[model samples]
Target: MVPEFFTQTNGRGDGEQTLAPDSSFSNLEEAEKALQELAQVFPQPHSFISGIGLDFATNEVSKAAVPPEAPLLNMEAKYRALVEQIPAVVFMAYLDQGIGEAYVSPQIETALGFSQSEWLEDPVRWYQQIHPDDKMRWSVEAAEMFLSGKPLRSSYRVMARDGRVLWFQCEAKMIRRADGSPWFIHGVGFDVTERKALEEAILEISAREQRRIAQDLHDGLGQHLTGIAFMSKVLEEKLSDKSLPEAEEAAKIVKMVNQAIENTRQLARGLHPVAAEPLGLFSALKKWASEVEGLFHIGCSFQCENPFPIHDVNLATHLYRIAQEAVNNAIRHGKSRNIVIGLSGKNGAGLLAIQDDGDGILKKQASQPGVGLSIMNYRADMVGGSLKVQANEGRGITVSCMFPIRSPE
Candidate 1:
């Protein structure tokens, strides 16, 4: 609040002139007249001007006080400090195009060699740095998240400023208004390059072991079983020639040995080489679906309305294994009676969807995925694809993998 007058003090005229203590006027006109009269006696340059701050609301002299926005400003500072000090790259941006609040942490410079200012300066810089191979799926998934208000959790490669390819496990959720409109997105991206490398090493070792066991079952155990069956049949014929009841016992031994051989072959097939089929993933999946139906006694079907060749062997392997795992999960965990596997490739991308007719995965279970689900997700990521497990509300679950059909020649 402004006071009526600011008095000049510590300067006197030719004699000792004393000023009145409470000579302030109520109106500015009276105060101006008194100030002009006083200025004539004591020249302005010789005196110091001073005034006491008055607080009329309190009816007392004004004292230092906190502004209304102080607490909120303090909380903002605290939260900003917390976010900046975290290990991962933290970001906040509006879910919509209109930028209400935008922030990128300092760790971005350490992680990707880009300063916080540089990242936030351009709105699309984050998307631009995504690995070229992963951009399309990211765009599609991001759009879905925006429209459906679902949280985004994914892992993909990003190109850093130093030309290094880094894998990141990114997770984000949308903040909404009271009316349920999206306000902003708070996200964190952790550098998982080392973790991904470790996971790949483990999967490779596991695959090698599986192939070794499959080879042994197919060649070593299967040949031994075949020999036993052949010898038992010879014994059964000899016993029959001798006109003895032992021929029936020998016939049972032959039957058991043959069954063992068939079981060994089935085990070997389940272990490996389905991915190495000549007709690529389509025929492999079709044959696998038939095998699943015959073996498990479940109704399984394969669909390929539009089919194309998958030239890349590793890609075929990944796709085949993904379908295999999805089907296995349906039979084992879901207890599904019917399963549908769909394959389609056109343009440069395709989808492999496996749907089951059983109890869908519970939401609680999905949050903590099992080992098979984890492996399936990893396989899809290795192939530059995204895997989505959608529950059909007590009907069943659908596991879909979206992947780019093109790979290096």
Candidate 2:
């Protein structure tokens, strides 16, 4: 008996398309005829009829099965939907081809007011959108990360399409081919503007409080100590004229009061170096070094090579504090016998570097920095500079801060 035959529409808009049973054709002529019809409908190379079947006895056929294209299309649609739904902007770039962004998630539009198409269309737009002051550092850091194939982690400001300055913390890693050659890069960016604003606010408040306390100590306590020392001197002179045994003791008391007054003045200076403004950074540094050497019995020297003037008092103060902190760390932690503080300026930039000839920072301590190092870094950032603390080649640690100097206008 001949097998049953049935035809099913393949759901394509084309009316002529049909499915046939998975059975042998009745004859070569019938098989040829079926193939010719399929070719006319789905004209391409390498077409196959899987379910179509025929019996030679009766020319009967069975039902056909659906094609593999349906499942693949569904998967692709789902993947795109998932990418678009993510909150953060997911990006992939072809590093080998001039760092072109191959894909940017849909969230970019909502985050930065720029469509994915707009970002992908311009390869240089990303670099161009960086804030002018940050462009050089950002480019250098990015280039280093790309060259070293290291994970890129950076926090920077980007100007969005609508002229909004947004801060983003981005992290990306190099993607490599099977043979270990770099293929591209992929990363995610998160908005950090609000967090940065909060941090800046806190830093400002702290700075204001420190200035107030320093002023109070200098104006209030320092004046009172000076008056006490003067009164004690006058009392010592009166006793000496009387030729009393208490005269010697009074003289000693006068000396002790003078010492206390000097100590109070030193404490006030420690709180905030008021001379930093009038004396300039160079003189303040020299005085500070002298004080450190006298107090700690360590060989501390300040050298300035072509010391350009720093008119901005706040900038000078921050730089002085960073140097002070570094010196203190070298003395207290490193037990340094000799420390060198150098200040130099060249081509609209200033550098303050401190090197200690003592026991170098331990590997563990370097990896896990303490509060002192953190404060130093924060101060460096406030002065528009970067702080680098590294162990010296032979011994000890070196702390360097390089900052920009605005030319007089």
The C-alpha TM-scores of every prediction are 0.73, 0.68
Q: What would the TM-score be for candidate 1 when compared with the true structure? A: 0.73
Residues 18-46, candidate 2, lDDT per residue (tens digit)?
Answer: 55554567797876666555545554413
In model 1, the runs with Cα more than 4 Å from the true position are 1-68, 96-101, 277-280, 296-298, 308-322, 328-337, 346-349, 358-386, 391-396, 403-406
Model 1 / residue 11 / CA error / Å: 53
Please give the lDDT score for candidate 2.
0.76
Give RMSD to native, each candidate.
13.8, 11.5
**Model 2 worst lDDT run, 10 consecutive residues:** 49-58
Total backbone collisions, model 1? 0
Best by TM-score: 1
- The weakest ten consecutive residues by lDDT in model 1 span 45-54
